[model samples]
Target chain A: MVTLEDARRIIAAAEKKAAEIGQPMNIAVVDGGGNLVAHVRMDGAWIGSIDISIKKAWTSRAFDITTQDLATHSQSGGQFFGIHASNEGKVMVFAGGIPLKKDGKVVGGIGVSGGSGEQDSTVAQAGEAAF
Target chain B: MVTLEDARRIIAAAEKKAAEIGQPMNIAVVDGGGNLVAHVRMDGAWIGSIDISIKKAWTSRAFDITTQDLATHSQSGGQFFGIHASNEGKVMVFAGGIPLKKDGKVVGGIGVSGGSGEQDSTVAQAGEAAF
Candidate 1:
């Protein structure tokens, strides 16, 4: 179970990184239970990125893998070629989602959107650092 | 729009109230767009309340009124007698949902479940106070 405090700190760190990069972003965090813990859309962030951010967090927590890895695995001729079609389309096989671990066990996940894949991943990495 | 911090504080307040009332609960918060912002299910909370709580928050934001008030309006032969059938069944006319307003504009909503209607309302009220 991730505390609300943990979620808040993660989002704050992610938001700071986004501002530093001169980008607005949508960020999401989910607890071990795969339930939303926190989510934010910075002023001027793309509205379309909201659900993407939340689903990225959920997908990471549900699969216990960073979305970058998932994307690689889901590539054509790879092990999870059609995984994106599952989970009501909530499985986002893309960068910017990372699981949060505590004592070597996944405790939550963080996701970011509204920027390039590398930028989003960078922001999500900042969020993960808070844990 | 309710920030992630706002949602976290609201959930914290709701959780505290639920603990004091000796009732485990599922709580959900949604932004002005009626998108999920945060959610939590305390240990031992009824699993059935998960979707109900989210929908309750959605209903509150969609209508800009408390779910309790919506219930009165949805009674048979009332002005909105069959309103529940609309919105893909996301409408929940109950006592546990409330809208969060800022500067007189409806900005978000919170919902609580897994207890009696009165108990759920009490917990939801605690969340509303966070804003």
Candidate 2:
């Protein structure tokens, strides 16, 4: 179980990376249960991405994989082709969400938005590295 | 505007109140735009109430009124009879939701669940008192 302190650390790391990249972001952190633990929307962050960020974190933790990887697997001919429609549109198969694992088990997830896919992925990676 | 710090403090206060009341809870905080700012589910908190808690906060901010008040207005023959049917059922008319006001403006909201309505409202008030 990821402690609240751990969630805070992950969010701080992600926020630092977002700042370094000059992109305001909405970041979400969710525990192993796919429940939100913490979230931060930086100044000037897009309001529309708030739910997306939360859902991205949820999707990452729910599937125990990075959303970027999920994006690839969810392609038209892939195993999870229609997975996006499964969770009432909460499944975000994109580049900004990453799972946080401890001892080979997913402990939590971090999701980032308000930037390009690459930028979002980079910031999410920075957050995942905290755990 | 409720800063990230304010959201954190609200959740923390709510958590403290829940602990004192011996109830594990799911708490949610939302900003002025009815966007989620932070959330926390204490260990042993019911997962079923996660979305409910969030929606409660959203409903509070969306209408600038407590869910308890909304419940009254939504009662049979009340001015808002059937108001619960609006917003795709995201409007939670209950006691756990309260708006956070600052400088005479609704700045955000806090929602709590996992206990009786009275307990939930008490914990939510502890959070709202933060601002």
Candidate 3:
């Protein structure tokens, strides 16, 4: 189970990394059920990204893959094209979302926003390390 | 005008109140534009309340009235009976939301869920007071 404590620990690690990189962020974590466990928007993070962050977390878990990978198949003429229109508009095909795994099994997900795709992915990876 | 710092302060106060009452809760804060600023779901709070809390905050700011009061006018046969069906289901006519006013003008809102109507409103009130 991805307990709330685990979510908090992950958020703290991500927050620290974002601080070190001098970027504010919106971070979210979801349990195996793809339900939100916790979320935070660091001061100065874009308010517009709040929804994107949560949707990205859900997309990562719902597909059991990093959103960057999903973006590949979700592009024009790709296998999962138009997937973003599914899930009532909750599917986010982009970077910055990574699935959380335990014992090599997908257990949850993390999403980060407020910077370039590479920056967001780096922060998300940092949070995953805390899992 | 509700910065992330303000949102955190509001959430902290609401969380404290929820804990004092022994009810884990979902809390959300929204800026004047009805955009989310931050949200948290206490360890054991219902996952379902996560969306509810966010919507409640938006609903309060959208109408500039406490959701408790809005609930009355939103009931069947009342003036705003179908308002909830509007806003793409983002409007919540409930008792857990209250507007955050700055110098008598609504500036933001706070929402609390995962308890009885009275409990939710009480917690939201504590958060609003912090602003």
Candidate 4:
């Protein structure tokens, strides 16, 4: 049972990390089951960020791995190449998503959109570290 | 480089299949990159069907697997549980989506919304068979 407070903290950490890297982003956090828990659309973020955030969160929850890891597989054309269509609005399979774990169990996930894929992923990684 | 013709044919086949089962549905077909190619909204379909259709199409394009495969894992609480947030309007992870393949290669996906999950999946599977 992950709390909303936990989701907020992760978002704050992710925002801070984006600022540090001079990137503005939209972020979304979801529980382990892929349900939306919290979301933030930053000023100057891209319109696509809203969808991207949700997708990133979905990807993290579905794969139980960082969005970056899925992106790696997506680029390599491996077993994950065509997996994105399976989840619909729930999977990004691209950069900028990370799963949040507590005590070795994935409790939630964080997603960042608006920046470049690399920058979004960096921000997401920062959020994961905060948890 | 898939065209609208391809999408329309798939939709017709899927709709025909739904009729065979006495299910009314909203169906969507999307290109390989998750872009909209064609869409059909049936009479008496649920309002949510539109979004669900898009999401299902998204899921197929993003995952490169039939929505049925994704639904199977979603039911089991596997790594795919939370990936739906990443693609926003594109991924469904439910039973109503199917990918379109040609010459054993994936080119697009079809999604049906409106019926029960099982019914929707059955119609989608029929569409796949048409192609």
Maximum-TM-score candidate: 3
The 10-residue segment of model 1 chain B with minimum total lDDT is B38-47
Per TM-score, what order, best first?
3, 2, 1, 4
Clash pairs, model 1 backbone? none
TM-scores, one per candidate:
0.79, 0.90, 0.93, 0.52
Q: How does candidate 1 score on lDDT?
A: 0.89
Q: Model 2 chain A — which ten-residue stretch has the worst lDDT?
A: A35-44
- lDDT tens digits, residues B27-95, model 1? 888899998777777766876887789888889999999999999989998999999999889999878
Model 3, range A1-131, lDDT digits (tens) per residue?
A: 68878998998899899999999999999999999888888878887788888888999999999999999999999999999999899999999999999999998999999999998999999999999
**Pairs that collide, model 3:** none
Best lDDT among the predictions, by candidate number: 3
lDDT of 1 at A23: 93
DockQ: which is higher, 2 or 4? 2
User: Between candidates 3 and 4, which one is better according to TM-score?
Assistant: 3
lDDT of 2: 0.88
The regions of model 2 sitting more than 4 angstroms off are A76-80
lDDT of 3 by residue, B3-122 (tens): 888998999999999999999999999988888888888888998999999999988899999999999999999998999899799888889999999999999899999999999999
Q: State candidate 4's DockQ.
A: 0.14
Q: DockQ for each candidate? A: 0.30, 0.52, 0.64, 0.14
Q: TM-score for chain A of every candidate model? A: 0.98, 0.96, 0.98, 0.91
Q: Name the regions of candidate 3 deviating beyond 4 angstroms.
A: none
Name the weakest run of 10 consecutive residues (lDDT summed) in model 1 chain A. Answer: A35-44
